[model samples]
Target chain A: MVKLTLNVVMAERNITSRELAAAIDITPANLSILKTGKAKAIRFSTLAKICKVLDCQPGDILKYIDD
Target chain B: MSKWLKFGINCVIVLGRISIVFAYLLIILPLGNFYPVIKGTLPKTILHNDNFLLLPGKHTVTAAAMQSFPSWPYAILILIGSIILIWAIIKHLKALIIILTNLRDADYFAVTTVGALKQLFIARIAMIIGDLFLASGNQLTRSWFYLVNNDGVMGATWSSAVADVWMAIFFGVIYVAYRYTLTLKAENDLTI
Candidate 1:
């Protein structure tokens, strides 16, 4: 099972979902889902865009928790 | 818009856009390139020109001759083909919209399933388009439409050779899209 945790990353960066969405051009609703790890998949391009905007690696935004 | 209508609208819009794209890749590009070859060379070569005296490998039709093969007829055919294909897609989209609209009042879970179906449809269309490219007998068509058959000009047909590299590139793109839409469970959940 794939488990992703991105909320902690956002919180650590002091980035609101709205702000992150604005920076990445995704809807806040989508960003919220992504942050909450409810996103079933993340585009590497989008992830790269997020990394560039947030000044972090994908590892910063995603952590896999094994079930 | 409700998720249902929004989803339906997105389906229509995406289908229209993709259909146009397919026309360009499959028919327009080949036929467009064909026009020049036909109009510039045909009559002179068909009866009098010694162009075909050499075998296919030995004979490389000149730019002018290549452009003259189908000439006016090619253009007319291409124009007709584009119109018909576009119309067919529009009709298809309308039907889809009607079906999706009826399902609008469906439960969220049902709506989500419909959304997945839409994604699957999109993926399928991409794959079909890719296959058409491979079948188009050119590098540009072969590579843009699919992956397995791009051996380049000599590897297949004149068109296939030209489209081979491009097909390779698009194959990667299709693979990525297929992976995203069908494989990545995490991100797909959101789209659903």
Candidate 2:
């Protein structure tokens, strides 16, 4: 399974979900979807923006886990 | 869409609804076989066998001919087929009205439109099968214009069967196109 670790990264950077969502120009609802791994997909552009705003690699936010 | 086009669609929807009410007459009028009130109201020109099965010298053989006419299962077949055909046409027309209404609202690309397309496809299939029964029953009914007008008003031959098949194929194609469109829409929606 592919799980997102965005909350962990956000917490490590001492940034709130609202701040990241505002910086990435996404609604907090959408950020919550991503954080909870409920989104069907993530766009490349959105991923690039999130990476830029959080100063993290894609790997740090997206991790592969087996269930 | 153009305003005129929208107006035209609305007009067609209204007309389509009106015609559905009249389409019931197709079944109701035929029931005159049993009901005297309906049979009495119809003009001789419509109910007379001579008008339906006219020969060159057969003008005088009119009145009691209906009593002698051997219309066994054929009449019943035609009635049943017409009922189903009318039902199918009503379904098709309703789906069309919904699609048009959605278009007027600039909401044509919706799951509702896809559902309407599916209903259109199903209605067409039902119509094709129903028409086969109608044409076959009409063929058996034989309007005796056999030599004069091979395919008269009530007597449609297999040629119409061919046209009906083509229509069903066209509906199938449209339904498949909309199915693909729905897939694309779903994928697009997921790509946030």
Candidate 3:
């Protein structure tokens, strides 16, 4: 299963959801869905934009665990 | 899909309601008048006036011709089949109107569309079975359905059901396609 660690990475970087959503040009609702791992899939361009805003790699945001 | 398409659909919905009433009257009036005269409850004098005969246009049936019918078993089948047939038609029109309303509102992928498609698919199948029974019943009661000049098709054979089978298949395909569309929309909505 692919689980997002976006909340942990944002907390570690001292960034609020609103600031990150505005910086990444995404709606707060969608950012919430992503942070809560409710999203079905993430676009590569959107991931690149998020990585750029957060100054982090995709691996820093995404984690896989066996069920 | 067009600017005035919704207007056209609304017109059809109105017309379909009227057609439903006519459908009932057409069948019911003929059966009502036919059975009473056959059983001798209604006087033959009642059918003496041409205007009093309630059969559809270009058709006339004598009480004697009606008396020649096999019996009430097939007549009962006809009544039951007609009821089921009309019910299926009503359901189809209702489902179509609802789905069209959803499209007009720009809610094409709404759950109501799936429900309407499923209803349509089931209704089509019901219509086919209803038509089969009606056709067979009519075939057995052929003497009564004669034309005014005694020159017309007596009754439909089971071969006529082929067209209904095709229609049911068409609706089944449409129902499956709509379900796939809804599934794709669900996946797309959750993607970010």
Candidate 4:
């Protein structure tokens, strides 16, 4: 399963979901969905934007877990 | 657009509640007076002329009229049809109130709203079917009583009901389209 490490990154950067959503130009609800690994897929453009805002690589925010 | 939708839903909710109250007061209330007719205790001639009459006032029927009076089958059918129509109205009103309440919360793309719309559609169809039963029952009553001499003159006109049925069908189609729109909105909301 592909899991998102957005919460860990946001926590390390000392950013709240609302602040990150505002900075990334996405809704807090959608950010919550992504943080909770409920999102089915993420756009590459959105990934690039999140990586730019958080000063991290795509590999830093995403991980693959073998079940 | 949501503002307009809220306003329209509020209007429908108010109108639906008022219609439910009026239906009970005007139609259901007078039905109690016809209990004797419904029970077949009184001579069915009392309802011969007014097949679809909700309330029949005090009238003295002659013995000769009683002898020639038609049976109670048509009157019973009309009574059942009236009950069904009232039931449909109440069901429609309940569905409208739920939909309006959900709309107030800006939950346009909800499954509950779609279910309510489906209920409203079914209620309208039931009302149309009730109207059909009323019309046919009235016609049968008139023919059985051989009261055709006053043709094109007195009695209830069913043309408006026919138009209403057509209007209901049109709105049913619109509701289907709205449901599709809601489905699309749901998909879009989840896409992010």
- Evaluated at residue B94, the lDDT of candidate 4 is 84
Per-model DockQ against the true two-chain complex? 0.19, 0.54, 0.81, 0.28
Candidate 3 Cα errors over 4 Å, as ranges: B1-3, B17-34, B37-68, B143-156
Please identify model 2 stretches exceeding 4 Å from their true place. A27-33, A36-38, B24-26, B33-70, B143-155
Better of 1 and 2 by TM-score: 2
Q: Give model 3's docking category.
A: high
Which prediction has the highest DockQ against the true structure?
3
Q: Candidate 4 lDDT, tens digit per residue, B98-161?
A: 8778878877677887787788788777777776766665565444343321322123236636
- The order by descending TM-score is 3, 2, 4, 1
Pick the winner on DockQ between candidates 2 and 3.
Answer: 3
Name every residue pair that clashes in candidate 2.
none
* Global lDDT of model 4: 0.70
Docking class of 2: medium
Candidate 1 DockQ category? incorrect
Tell me the tens digit of each residue's lDDT in model 1 across B1-192.
487677776676567567656644644433453544555643342334332133323334355544434445533433443444344444445435444544554533343444434543453343334433333323322232221222221123434334534644654564456445544544455641
Q: Give stretches of model 1 more than 4 Å off.
A: B1-192
Measure candidate 3: CA RMSD: 5.4
Decide which is better by lDDT, 1 or 3. 3
